[model samples]
Target: MDLASEEDKEITIGAFNGWDESYAAAYNTKYALEQDGFTVAVESFDAGPAFTAVSQGDIDFIMDGWLPVTHEDYIQQFGDDMEAQGCWYIDAKNTIAVNEDSPAQSMADLADMADEYGSTIYGIEAGAGLTRMMQDNMIPTYGLEDWDFKISSTPAMLAQLASSTDAGENIVVTLWRPHWAYDAFPVRDLEDPEGAMGAGEVVYNFSYAGFTEDHPQVSQLLKNLVISDEDLASMENIMFSDDHYGGEDPDGAVAEWVEENDSFVSDWKAGALAG
Candidate 1:
């Protein structure tokens, strides 16, 4: 009889920065897979770098692709190279939030207050898909050609926002729903006159092409995965409930949720063994 190949098998999952909202779901999935006896590795990369790495197969998967919009090109190029696991969050929306007292109530309002607001828009890292959308579409479409946009990473941008909001100064920063900021701050989303940013999007997971074949049971669990706004909100709430609530404990919360939803978990596990 021929011996099977000696090479060991392991799954590597990729994620954006450690602070991304999807980090929790990714950890939860990792925990679930490990429970089934598979050796798994978790890797972190910048959002843009993560897409490139996954495309080149340097990473096994990224569980945080916001869909039908952001990262559209990345999905098109690398999607065929991987298997889409499942939907994570269905309505992840991006917003342009200004300080609560800012006179700019909408994109149109920004035009009138461009001078007072410094003729500049605060954005996350320039490479972020949303930042590109803001520059390539929101700016031009809204006719803010002369307006300047400052691109900084999330922590940096949020820091600027905190300073401005605390002083009740005029400020605008790219924001998103289902993010920790929504739970921690009272900023408002500016109305879109041209609708350039598009509506909320569906977030999903992706794995290497043969992941399902190599780990059918684990793939099944991923396929049955579905998270709603309430689910995400609960996680965010825990992170902000108190100074002692800790932060971003997605895996722990997921495990707790699963145990409390045994019937639902069983349904997901059902038929998975046949694969």
Candidate 2:
């Protein structure tokens, strides 16, 4: 396939709302696509609607899907109209994290230390799969039925996390790996001895039906994409940092990341075009 001869060069990428990894991947992929002389637009939606839009061909692809567990319901509903482009990131896991110095080290310990941690478990959107797992599995299994499971937006939860941690107060909040928080905050995941949180999952790129056939080069790019934890973290750290978050130059951040990983970018582009 000649990159310059592609007919469908304009693309729409979907991302989940308030998901750092989602936007990080979307913008990064946007940068790559733009570099290849393709026009890209990224739109954000909650998980459910994002899946629906992609299945209906409203968007071309999304890069922040967690497989085998987190996003299982959406997949079951829309899998027939979507293509799994393969995992770009492995070791993805939903977690309930607490301050690093907190005495409670596991979900089992949260029940007893409820008062110390304010008898609350902060969480992201109520509809999120992470929230569902906590409500249905982790909370009950760990005897935290009476505890406050506060449902709110991811930013709100993170704000609370920031305030609590800054005060040296104990706090617990729902979080996930492949996230910038682990690097920016003084927090750690609580052990789930009973496996209520499920095993680690892989992050996949999904496209609408026939997306591959429509844009073979982009499909090849998706297939060839694989980001290491270290690189992803670095990019996200820059992306979500105070200077870049909601800043005027969002693309500049991605450009900076790309400049830093020029060799990887070159190899990735070459591999995709070679197909």
Best by TM-score: 2
lDDT of 2: 0.85
Query: Which candidate has the top score in lDDT?
Result: 2
Local distance difference test scores for all models: 0.71, 0.85
Quote each prediction's TM-score. 0.67, 0.79
- Considering only N, C-alpha and C atoms within 3 Å, which residue pairs clash in candidate 2? none
Model 2 C-alpha lDDT per residue in residues 1-275, reported as the tens digit of each score: 35566788899999998777888888988987887789999998999999999999999999988888879999999999999876788879888899999999988998889789889999999898889999999999999999999999888998898889999999999998888777677998899999999899889999999998898888888887787766777788778866355433558888988887787667776664223
Residue 105's lDDT in candidate 1:
75
State candidate 2's TM-score: 0.79
